[model samples]
Target: MPLYKTLDPNSQTHVKIWKITETYEDLLQPLSLKPESLERVSGMKSELHQRGFLSVRHLLRAFGYTDLDLYYDEMGKPHLKDGMHISITHSFTFAAVAISDVEVGIDIEKQRDKIAVIAHKFIDYEFDYLNKYADDYIRNLTVIWCVKESLYKLFATPGMLFREHFFVIPFTLEDEETISWIDYKGQKCRFNASFLEFEGFTCAFTLPS
Candidate 1:
């Protein structure tokens, strides 16, 4: 099992990352998936996606749970059968999960120049602090994107615009963590977000304040 890293951010929260070096068949051998899960995996067109899905199940096993202990809502947000708050994310060669007693969300994204092209779609208030010509432009953009995505997952509300409703407070790359807010439908909430970079990918996670 390529369990890349396990983090206990707090006493009540568990974060696990898996580096997917195993083939589809190798990842499939040790687990039994629910009928729906099997069907879902079978329908995935990408082998990398399939491996990411199965690797998550293995991550669950590391947490003393299994495919049987997870389910998704109508919004497609995953939930734990036992009621612990959970969020999952998977990118090209990486998969991650975050579970906490409090509400949480997680995301992993490969750092790429392409995100710079689409940054405007998801960034608003953050632009004031962003310098496109800066050396860390791509890295900063990736963090902002992941931060908004994590907030979106935690909010799970329909029609929430990332540019209009989500805002990430400014912070230098050295900060590693910062505060963000969700303002939508006349309600406001704050969250604490942190990020890390490894092997050219950025992983960001949020916990409600």
Candidate 2:
């Protein structure tokens, strides 16, 4: 089943989350496919690849678009001719997407305690900010991790370090979302990121403003 959530920042955008609950045959729906795109979907088994295609199709149907009018840029960013921005993500059992006139990114992550072990790689000055929260530390760290990953996807950059290029502004646990930004090579982009706890997983997404 797919879960749908709306961000309050922009009334025009919609976010959808899909937890993989169908088999390959059921989710792919080969009998209902167009030949060319069907061939493409048939060629992969990486869960992420399959879910990406399916998620878009799910959105298309939801929006009353039946022909799958989508294309990808050289950088592999998917675009719609009718002009809506899109972002996609998937994990072992979940997939997510957000579409809006504004650029956006969404990420879902299984909440794990081990995130602390590798924090140094993606974390830079942000460590100072995180260090202030000594209790429930792992949960907060996972939030930062997901927020940075979403920002990187939104930025579409291959060489960004979460810790070095972006920062999540401090917010309390009661706050569902927080402010974050990327200062990449002096180019700045601000993002509003939010996370919700889902069955032991933490999912976060960013909307560019």
Candidate 3:
């Protein structure tokens, strides 16, 4: 499929999503990827991952960019050739890209019961407001995971651990928004975390507070 959805939180930021319904050859034939990128995708063990990689490239085209115009840092964070801040994520059958003039990160995750098992690994302060018995417990956990992952990508700094450094403020599913903090080394930074749910998946992005 073509671009599945596009979001604009402000004049300078754009988030685009893609649903990967095309076959590997269908996705690969349209775009021009550098040799390294071709080799990179060719080495993938799963076709699902390969399609996810191609889908993100198609998203860049939706924003008038090409695969060559995108690059990654040593931290594995994505960047644009024009100095724009960018984040890319793909999970299961979906892929998304976010671009902004300011620091930003984005993530998409499938809402699954399995997230609860690893909750303690990346969750700390959020537990205070989270009730395990609530009907929305799993949904809430998915959102928190999505938000924190985005923050991690946006911060893109080594030595930052989610449980130790990221704290999400209280939020409800209806609100679709929240505040999050990065506290480490006695220094703290704030960010705005916003999210949406569709097709049993949640996508979250972070920007300056």
Global lDDT of each model? 0.93, 0.74, 0.94
- Local accuracy of candidate 3 as per-residue lDDT tens digits, 1-209: 57899999999999999999999999999999999999999999999999999999999999999999999889888888899999999999999999999999999999999999999999988899899999999999999989989999998889999898999999999999999999989989999999999999999999998
- For model 1, residues 86-144, the per-residue Cα lDDT tens digits are 99999999999999999999999999999989998999899999999999999999999
lDDT comparison, 2 vs 3, better candidate: 3
Measured with C-alpha atoms, the lDDT of residue 171 in candidate 2 is 71
Pairs clashing in candidate 3? Answer: none
- 10 residues in a row with least lDDT, candidate 1: 1-10
lDDT of 1: 0.93
What lDDT does model 2 reach?
0.74
Model 2 alpha-carbon drift over 4 Å, by segment: 1-9, 30-37, 46-56, 131-135
Off by over 4 Å in 1: none
Residue 122 of model 1 has an lDDT of: 96
| Ten-residue region with minimum lDDT total, candidate 3 | 1-10
